[model samples]
Target: MSVQGTPDELVEILRETVVSLVRRDGPDLSARQLGVFLTVYLGEGPHTVRGLAEALNIGKPAITRALDRLEEFKLARRKINPADRRSVHVQRTTRGAALLREISVTMAEAANPQRTAGTPTGSQQGLKP
Candidate 1:
C-alpha cells in the first residue's frame, strides 16, 4: 500500500520512530555515519569509495571513516573489485539488511495506529495541524 500523510503527520511518525529506535538496543549512529550507511544500503550497490564520496559530495577520507564505523557494527563491508583490483566495492551485509528492516517495521508501526500499542491518534500525538 502507498504511504500517504501530511508533513505534520510525517513528522509525528518520524518522532515515534526515533523514540522506538532509542528504546531498541544499539549504539547511536552519527548523522554522517547514518547518511553514508543509508546511501550505501538504499542506493545502487557495488559502490566504490570514490563513487560514494562523490554521491555524498563528501571527501573520500570521510567516507572511509564512515565505512570503518559501519564495518565495526557489522553493517557494511568492502571488497576488492575483481575487475579492477585498485578499487573496492561496498557490499551489503545481512546485519545491515536486518537493521534496515527493523527501521522499516518501526516506521510502519508508527504510521499504522492499529499496529501500534498505546499510541495516541491524530492531535493526541502532540502534532499541530
Candidate 2:
C-alpha cells in the first residue's frame, strides 16, 4: 500500500525518530546537543560554534550550552584552531562517531518502519527528515 501521510508528516516522523534515538542513547545530549555534534560530524572542515549557530539559526549562547553538554559526554571536543588560537573548533571524537552511527541506524530503522514487511517508505530526500 502507498503511504497515507503527507510528505511533511513523514518528515515529522523521521525527525521524531532522530530525536528519540538521541534521547535514548545519548543520555547526556539534548536534541540541540546532538544537532550540534552532527553538524561538525558532517562538515568538511572543523565547525566553529559561530558556524554552528549560523547553520542552526540558533543564538551563540545556546550553541555554547549544547557544546558544553557534548563535551561533558566525551562525544565532542573543543580544540583550539591552529590558525587562530582564540578560536575553537568542535570535532567529533571516536565516541561521537560511534554515537552517530548508532543514531543513523536507529533513524534508518525508524524511517523504514515497514522494513520487516518488505516495503520501505523513505521518500524524503534529505537526512533531517
Candidate 3:
C-alpha cells in the first residue's frame, strides 16, 4: 500500500518513525545497514555481497561491513553459495522479519497517530499548529 502525504507530512512521519525506533530496545541499525537489510529481506534474493554493492552503489567492503553488523545482530546471515564457493549469499533471519514488522507498525502509527492507542496526536508529534 502506498502512503500519500505532502512532503512535510512525509518528513514528519519519517522523523516520528525513526524516533520510535531509536527509543525501542533493539538493534539500532545505521542507514546503510537498514538499507542493506531491507534490500535483502524486501527484495527478491539470492542476494550476494557483489550484487548488494552494485545494487546499493557502494563498494564490496562496505557491503561486507554492513553484512557483518547484520550477522552480528542475527538480522541477516552470510552463507557460502554452494553453486559458487567464491560468492556469499545474504539470508534473512526471523529477527530481521520481526524488525521489519516493527518498522512497518511504527511507520503506520506515525502516519496515523489517532489510529494507535496511547500515541500522541499529530499536533503533538511535530505537526505545525
TM-score for each candidate, following the candidate numbering: 0.81, 0.72, 0.87
**lDDT of model 1, residue 37:** 87
Ranking by TM-score: 3, 1, 2
User: What digit string (tens of lDDT, one per residue) describes model 2 on residues 1-129?
Assistant: 355567875675666665567467455566688788878898766788888999999999999999888888888899999999989988879988988888778666655646525543344444442
Task: Note the residue pairs that clash in candidate 1.
Answer: none
Candidate 3 global TM-score: 0.87
Best by lDDT: 3
Q: Which parts of model 3 are misplaced by more than 4 Å?
A: 116-129
**Model 3 lDDT, residue 20, Cα:** 86
Count of clashes, each model? 0, 0, 0
Candidate 2: count of backbone clashes, pairs at least 3 residues apart or interchain: 0
Q: Where does the lowest 10-residue lDDT sum fall in candidate 1?
A: 120-129
Output the number of the TM-score-best candidate: 3
Candidate no. 1 TM-score: 0.81
TM-score of 2: 0.72
Record all residue pairs in model 3 with backbone atoms less than 3 Å apart, i.e. clashing: none
Give the poorly placed runs of model 1, Cα more than 4 Å off: 1-3, 115-129
Per-residue C-alpha lDDT of model 1 across residues 1-129, encoded as one tens digit per residue = 476999877887987777776788984677788888889888987799999999999999999999999999999999999989999999999999998998888898788857765766546766554
Question: Candidate 3, residue 103: CA error in Å?
Answer: 0.5
